[model samples]
Target: MKMTDPTTSAATPDEELSALVMQISSLSKLALDMTKVCIDVKDKLPHVIAAQAAKIAMAIPETGETVSTPWFEFLDAPTPEEMAARYPSTNGDGQNYHVVCAGRRPGLYADPDDATAQVTGVPNYVREKRKGRFEALRFYKAVYREGRAFTAIDVIVSDDDDE
Candidate 1:
């Protein structure tokens, strides 16, 4: 199919925005279609093709760079489940806390401007420091690309741990 050059004049900013919205809609539909195909094929898909798809899915569109840190290196961090296993869920006073998933922000909720503050799956961290023990929130580098989609997960050491 012949692709239109995005640089071509759209006449107005509203027109450009509309075009962008349509493009996004098309992309989303294509992604859904692709997902269906992948589900149907599953194990039958070739390793190389699967690898390329993974890379594409994890890549930064502008730079074509993988958003995730190296898998082996990321695996070095302690997962959220591991952290929960090691740490006490509640204090002696009965104040409950949990390793809640978050993004860049140290809090459980994402900041309006920081998209990376949104959490997805289980988060991981290098280690919880002594200072972090006393704080209400602690942010960690996300190990997986999807986890990093917004940023890092937070270990919320507060009664508000609702994740």
Candidate 2:
């Protein structure tokens, strides 16, 4: 395949990096919001509300392709060739790669947006999964690139992955 122009591919790596960084940030924010909801109220947050927030909070990133859902089926979604044109693979660094996340809570529901939530053979990596409810109503991010891929750099969560 013909590689994208340098100016075009130049932003690909940065986009991937930005995606991963935002993922970590989002996970942290979700955990924080859930904890806040738990502490502020006497009861657990409603699943629908939590679910909705989760949808909004967890966003799948796009470089050229659009994320119909945040988690699962990134491949099934449509991509504008012009958007795909922006990403040219790095020699080995995976500069133009993509990202998806799925967390399995005991009450986990299949979100059209969740990638890991949909597949069984793949691990849900519940260590990082958020459990129970959100207070914030708006939990969505728009199409953009993360600072890095989820697996590319270090992520620091306050609690243990299983906690």
Candidate 3:
């Protein structure tokens, strides 16, 4: 971020605020370019297809029309993180997309100590964010060693929670 003195500048106070807004906008765009893939899309499409196949193959037949098409994919609702990446970030201070703890009853959790569970692919964070309801984001510092990824977490700050 560039630092500028308001004292000497001919620009008005409103102009300075606007300048700050523009800088924040640019920073957010750059952040999206850097982290969109891992945050926005994490191979959920493949899983969707696989789940559909499992559904169709099961003993109980689905009454809905047999699935097939590009259109069908769009119907699969995009996650809020995906929307956040694609949608413009008005404020640069939104939240980190990676290492999200969301789903049912989202909150910080103690690192799981189970070795067998660790061997199986499991995210340390649990998501409780309901579909169509994106509450907040969680940030993390990660370390990979001994065939596992460990993280230190920081949750997005919220006023609603305080209320």
As for model 3, its CA RMSD to the true structure in angstroms is: 21.0
Task: Show model 2 residue runs off by greater than 4 Å.
Answer: 5-7, 12-15, 43-163
Instruction: Return the clash pairs for model 3, or none.
Output: 102-127, 102-128, 103-127, 103-128, 103-129, 104-127, 104-128, 105-128
Angstrom error at residue 21, model 2 = 1.0
| Number of the top lDDT candidate | 1
- 32-139 per-residue lDDT for model 1 (tens digits): 999999886774455435434544443323465543442211112244444435454344423323323333333322233332323233233212222332232334
Q: Summarize candidate 3's per-residue lDDT along 1-163 as a digit string, tens digits.
A: 8778878766799999999999999999998887877664454555545545532343233478562311111112234344346444345433432222322122222233332222233223232222221333222111111111222222345579887
Error of 3 at 109 (Å): 28
Question: In what order do the candidates fall by lDDT, top score first?
Answer: 1, 3, 2
The TM-score measured for candidate 1 stands at 0.21
Write one digit per residue (lDDT tens) for candidate 2, span 61-141: 436876443243111111223223433323443121112322321112224345343333322222122222220000101
Q: Estimate each model's TM-score.
A: 0.21, 0.21, 0.21
